[model samples]
Target chain A: GAGVSQSPRYKVAKRGQDVALRCDPISGHVSLFWYQQALGQGPEFLTYFQNEAQLDKSGLPSDRFFAERPEGSVSTLKIQRTQQEDSAVYLCASSESGRSYNEQFFGPGTRLTVL
Target chain B: GESVGLHLPTLSVQEGDNSIINCAYSNSASDYFIWYKQESGKGPQFIIDIRSNMDKRQGQRVTVLLNKTVKHLSLQIAATQPGDSAVYFCAERGKGAQKLVFGQGTRLTINP
Candidate 1:
């Protein structure tokens, strides 16, 4: 009955600092995804996971962005050397299946502000 | 170089009137389309979705139309209400692709 949840709803960091955001997907979800949304713009895909396997990471902006879903239930997104361009809302979503047609339930998202 | 884009940045309509939001996708290979609604301080919520094989799909108070030949998509809301005010986004998934490409959102304002 619980929806996807993210930790540290808002985060502020100085330039060059490292930050990690957490996401708790719904129970029994097989597919998880991460996205970055800039202000007034649509969300952009970052990565995807299926049962703890990192299947797609093509959308990661650079080497600084890394994600993991070690146990297949919870996922973490890490950003190293935070840059002003990285300031945006990071959203987490999970679906019942790994198929592209399934609807994804999204989390409230973590807003990261780099100064 | 292909992307999903909206025709308008904002749309205002009176309560009880119908509202329409349009989107254009450059990728003809896109096979799945979805519409999402988002409010301030919240994540996107799925409204409805349609596959490329279907031309239209209907949900509670909302309908989605897809024109594969032209790569156009539209969301129609019946009896628009104040609670329907939010930013609407159209997303597409190319055939066999695992990722969704989202379009610029349309801000819907309901004047009650």
Candidate 2:
């Protein structure tokens, strides 16, 4: 079975530019999550979606970070006015259900480099 | 203020030897813990998980031990192989929380 997939494995952006990262979760997965991982650090949760509903966005660092899963299958994370501090790998994951105990299948993240 | 942290930044073990990675979490409300392995240029891969109610759980060659009283967790891998060389992370999910708090990660090197 195909696992989660993300686009633009690497991206370079100028300061103040906006960037968008996409994620395709596994087929029939009901839960999706986004996380940000800085260099040499573990991933930190960014947002979560259960189907098309955006349940939690607490981990998003700032208002510039926005995410949506409008169709319930694909999700996107967008950062406005990118900054050096926003440079990190954005990871996407999905699980069979919304329960915390379920194993989350992750995708090869998109590494964003802000200059 | 809540965070998961690793005691060691790196660990090196010989091939066929066992390896242990330790983690400490500050949140006492954490009820679910998971271990993940990550290679260069990839996302974290789910290794194993254990709940607070259970003291230990095993899967394949990996075992996860959770000590709620001490707010500690550990992951043990038997017969470490070259393929096991990567960064390992411990994550915790607090009760009623949807997000997972991850540790800094411990780099494991397997010397053959």
Query: How many clashes in each candidate?
Result: 0, 0
lDDT of 1 by residue, A1-115 (tens): 8999999999999999999999999999999999999999999999999999999999999999999999999999999999999999999999999877999999999999999
- Which 10 consecutive residues of model 1 chain B have the lowest summed lDDT? B92-101
Q: Considering every candidate listed, which one attains the maximal TM-score? A: 1
Interface Cα RMSD, each model = 0.8, 0.9
Best by lDDT: 1
Q: Cα deviation of A15 in candidate 2 (Å)?
A: 0.7
How accurate locally, in lDDT, is each candidate? 0.96, 0.95
Q: Write the per-residue lDDT of candidate 1 for residues B6-111, one digit (tens) a residue.
A: 9999999999999999999999888999999999989999999999989999999999999988889999999999999999999999888878899989999999
Worst 10 residues of 2 chain B by lDDT: B92-101
Per-residue lDDT tens digits for candidate 2, residues A1-115, read 7999999899999999999999999999999999999999999999999999999999999999999999999999999999999999999999999977788899999999999
Q: Candidate 1: global Cα-lDDT?
A: 0.96
Which residue pairs show backbone clashes in model 1?
none
